[model samples]
Target: MTTTSPQIVASADGTPIAYESMGDGPPVILIGGAFNDRTTVAALAATLAPHVTAVVYDRRGRGDSGDNADTFAVEREIEDLAALIAAAGGRASLFGHSSGGILALEATAQGLPVERLAVYETPFVVDGLRPLPAEGTAEQIRAFVAKERRDEAVRLFLTEQVAVPAGMVDGMQASPAWPFLVGLAHTLPYDVAVCGADLALPADRLAKIGVPTLTMAGGASPAWFPAAAQAVAGAIPGASYLTVAGQDHGVLHNPDALREPLLTFLR
Candidate 1:
């Protein structure tokens, strides 16, 4: 079987953003954490595609999208999302995970025409959310990527930063895809950037957002991530917060546990 290529759209800054479509229903856009491309999110898309029209895209600099050599800012990514939503018929329900959640919140903050928002583990550094692993975390990740220890980088990211259980990390490290994840690991800093100042918005700033928002965190996820989710939930008005039992940051890949709550919110 052949996969259709993602459609390219020009963002506000004129950078190209790539996106793909599947299924038929109210349009839903799937935004991934840093370093994740549409292919990595195929499983989640497959589940949602059968229900709602699912649009998955490569955030700039990865997959089929254009890249800026100087490293684009988080605001630029928000614009990229806006362009994609516009292409999806001028409005879309956004479902973002990790750093993508950060983008979703920022987009909502900027008053984009998003209909609804569902976010998972956005890593907002509020309420004692654990700080990034020291100052050299980004540098260490770069070194791993440089040595082509891509799988190693992914492992470190999942285990150390993502707070994945040690047992799960050990098992995943043995998988063949670990190498691919590591190769893309260098993009970790981009995810951090996407989060911007991490709930830096003032009270009035957050109160201005009126989109129906759903903030989700995995019950088994680290305390910090859930704290971050709560922070986001508190900031937005009328946003409902829920915890998905037995789910984690990677719940997007584990749709059996995630789809119901997600569809319920987005649909």
Candidate 2:
């Protein structure tokens, strides 16, 4: 389950997408959530490596990936994946976290060659327990990034949009992960675009996903996460659902709890 150094593949539009693949089995690309690059999902990728060919990649505008487009659109991200899948012999399973989950679903719904799909804590605001992002939140984040205020952008996105408590964000800022979050802040708008401003689920797209799908949430997460995950599973006909006990949104860092479910589903 070991991996070689990272490599590059030219995505559609010639954007060089950096990725690393571990093991040898049915390929499963791991799409990381907002404020995350490939390294953020390294733990989960390693966990699944022995069971599946886990592919971890840096999405455009983050890590070593090239951002060729002037405007950030979800379709471009899909095309980046399209290229990656093509490299994986034209078909591969997918695993996305949070906003990355939304992107993966969109790719599958749009008729990509996805063999299977699994998403954790997709984070749609299905229930009314929490308020949606205020209008222009995305714009504000974009402005912060444009102004080279990466730290500010990260704080705003986490506290205001992702609903992480302010104090929690303060602690995160002091953690080692804070540097990565700040480094990837320029891509926050790409995440915001994937997760619509209101954080509403796209029922039409979910209905179009015909592949086997697994939607999961952490039991320890706020009440709305499981609700959102269930709604996602319910939307895709015959999709499976799970709530991993004692896990939460930060499960990416300590993802051993996900190994069994991921192996059972994607293997």
Candidate 3:
């Protein structure tokens, strides 16, 4: 049955966390990666709506969510997610992409009442796959945002952090919405911190993760991303891993390509 989406004003760390809910089934909360808002992954929610309830939210400082002057941290993000899950009536499955995947892993580690999880390409960098940016880039990005040069900061992040092709970066630079694209560049560090220390966590820590799990990677995704997904799957007991054909870190942009695989695995 079709259901209209409604915004829920949830409180997290005194900031208003804006979220949207749709469908009616076992709740499935969708958390987006850095700089992406609730609507950014709306397509994926629509695809999942028929089989499972999908709750999508804007993390603090992005989309309709409120921002705080305090430095951003993964712990704060976990709280934001907890509030959303509480608003959803306590327990729900989780699907996270990129940085969002790391957030899901952390939530599960802390035992957040998630029934199951599907984590896609967290970019943990555990095996020297993709190197982090040089020391000065973070400072440079902060400066760009402080000067209100959002696009330039975003360009640096895409070209340096995500390692998107130079041509693609060049193309996006000329797009009319480049400014908005970079508006959240200040949040890049949050993604980096989530995957910091090369994500070299010991296996014993993951062994205690007593929940059904699905680790996903994009078939056409970069090798580094698949590597991290594989690492995560291998570390967790009884976790299943799969790659969605023709999907990438931008899976929300190609929801139809991933929906079937995701539904089959999660359900």
Judged by lDDT, which candidate is best?
2
Write down the TM-score for model 3: 0.89
Off by over 4 Å in 1: 129-132, 136-175, 197-205
lDDT of each: 0.77, 0.90, 0.78
TM-score of each: 0.83, 0.96, 0.89
lDDT for 15 in candidate 1 is 81
Native-vs-model 2 lDDT? Answer: 0.90
How far in Å is the alpha carbon of 65 misplaced in model 3?
A: 0.8
Q: Which pairs of residues collide in candidate 2?
A: none
lDDT, candidate 1, at 81: 85
Output the lDDT of residue 187, model 1: 69
Global CA lDDT of candidate 1, please?
A: 0.77
Residue 212, candidate 3: how far off, in angstroms?
A: 1.0
User: Over the stretch 1-267, how does candidate 2's per-residue lDDT look in tens digits?
Assistant: 124467899987999998888877999999998988888888888888887888899899888789999987999999999999988889999999999999999999999999999999997988696888877898999999999999999999998789888999999999997987888899999998898888998987899999999999998999999999999999999999999999999889788998999999986
TM-score-wise, the better of 1 and 2 is 2
Ranking 2 against 3 by TM-score, winner: 2
**lDDT agreement of model 3 with the native:** 0.78
Off by over 4 Å in 3: 1-6, 197-205
Give candidate 1's error at residue 152 in angstroms. Answer: 8.3
Error at 88, model 1, angstroms: 0.8
